[model samples]
Target chain A: MVPQEHPLEQLLRSDRMPHIWCPGCGLGTDLGCYLRALSGMDLDKVAFVSGIGCSGRAAGYVAVDSFHVTHGRGIPFAIGLKVANPELTVTVWGGDGDIFAIGGNHFIHAARRNIELNVICINNAIYGMTGGQVAPSTPLRAKTTTTPYGNYEHPFNFSYMAAASGATYVARWTTAHTKELTKSMREALEWKGFSFIEVISMCPTTFGRRNGFADGLEMLKDMKARSEVKNFPDLEDTDIGEKIVVGKFVEKEKRSYLEEVKQWR
Target chain B: MSMKSWQNQRGFLFLKEERCKGCGFCIDLCPKKVLRQSEVMNAKGYHPPELYDVEGCIMCDICTEICPDFAIYRYRSKERGKNA
Candidate 1:
């Protein structure tokens, strides 16, 4: 019963109305923004690639030409797609464990090379599909299947890592705020250099149940209330690395790797 | 195809059911009242949105935009026009 003029009217599959994601999970909001971004841009020449995990299945949900790649190899496949077809707008999709953990090396090197591709990292903090195990992004002291006694390790700040690794575009947002997430995704897709969007998702069934949250919606509300916009005036020494800043962290015009390769002629 | 013309003729939307608590968030959000509660239940036993009239649906997918669960999709065909 949706109207045809709405931006998101075309990308969905009616037969697949009810998705497989758990109730109160944040993946829906993240997916909605991602699709809105895709719909807003020119996608006739776009190709989506995904790695193993719940986020990996994103390719199958949308209407774009998608490639389901091997576990921890989505970015590499997207890189190859861009290299072979420079005109194609390639986007890589994966989870925190797949990108920032198991495929951590590839993630850094890709940014270091300034690969001209969009990487959507869905950070749920824990490995949802693999039985709620603690991920590299799992906060310290957070309980998980592997860390039932509480994790002693610190979680990785994905946007910071991308910025430090030479990516041309880096941004962070949570699923609770869809408008900002969609806006950032749209910009990242238009960037000519490597673009990374880190989305803090909710694995309610696992992360919530283990962390003592009543449900995923509670976690989402917490994330919404706890996140702050990054502003220069808001900077405080004590706030450094203590508060989560959500916004466009970095974006600049740079020589894209694919463009540089083409110029070699 | 001209970029502007192609864009004008083609459109799409996505529905994310994971966020849906099946509380009918989009059902109340749509201005046109295009969406309705479905009798069929999904694997999760939540009744998803069901389109009452396919032709009446203008492909607005506003249902998707306002849905708290992110459940509702719309798509328009470029090569085939708006028939199917």
Candidate 2:
């Protein structure tokens, strides 16, 4: 009966068998890292919120008080829960477009206010769910459905943005770095102030086939070969071409918005 | 590599064949090269991997973690007696 059950059967929504992610997608791997971080923790104290995108489906699959919120609105919803019950570990998972494009304002304000929340952005470069449209995180000269001639606009450096917005904890990791990613997630889960993790996962279906990768494995191998770890990654060099830099860019102990508000009252 | 030897190394390594999408992440990334793509197709028309090697399999469970489809899982033998 080796095929009887999955190891994370208790952690996942087994009734919703066979997730919707395409074959060779990296979203599954990212979810696996999140699940590993959830291990040895009280599930009742967790509340997962996800915005619209391929990564958005993540909220529905986890066996927790998960919320599949509106586009780019995951942060606000998570904030509502955290404010109402500060004890819950509120997390928002979204794609590059969902987090950086539509939810950009909320993200910046939340970070600036130093909210006690964990924000995970899985940047696949383009909008994978909507046919690989050019996104704010897409690298310069990268091709997408809307930017077939290559994107001329410069891309946003997510780690740099999070740090500049006053996030206490910011880190960047690719899907290939599983152990490191899981470790980063665990740290963020335990941290007090605003924390952001940007994961460079693969989108072989739309972003890959058009960009030259034959499959997710090839993209993962390329990421493994191209990625360089740096504790102090140069923010200016994060364009996702030539080579990729991955590591913890900024981490500091700071008072969260809730703590400050309570003191002011 | 024989089945007996593979079993000796692994207390339990499960795969939900129907859930596999044949992405080959587990097989390609396996540290020990213990698995290969099975020729048969499942209900989803994807070729799930099968264990073929008996040597060098550390039973690291990397496949279980790396599998995007969540098709692979492992249980440690009672002799080793660590948590799954």
Please tell me which predicted candidate would have the highest lDDT against the true structure. Answer: 2
TM-score of each: 0.78, 0.94
For candidate 1, the docking band is incorrect
Model 2 spans > 4 angstroms off: A1-4, B1-6, B78-84
lDDT of 2 by residue, B49-69 (tens): 888764456667798888887
Question: In candidate 1, what are the lDDT values of residues B17-79, reduced to their tens digit?
Answer: 333456554665456675677676555677766656444555554555535444455565543
Query: For candidate 2, lDDT tens digit of each residue in A1-265?
Result: 3434666778899777689999889999999899989888899999999999999999889998999999999999999999999999999999999999999999999999999999999999989888888899887887889888988998898888999999999999999999999999999999899999999999999988988899999999998899999886667776567788898888998889999999988
User: Which candidate has the top score in DockQ?
Assistant: 2
lDDT of each: 0.73, 0.87
Residue A256's lDDT within candidate 1 is: 77
lDDT of 2 at A147: 85
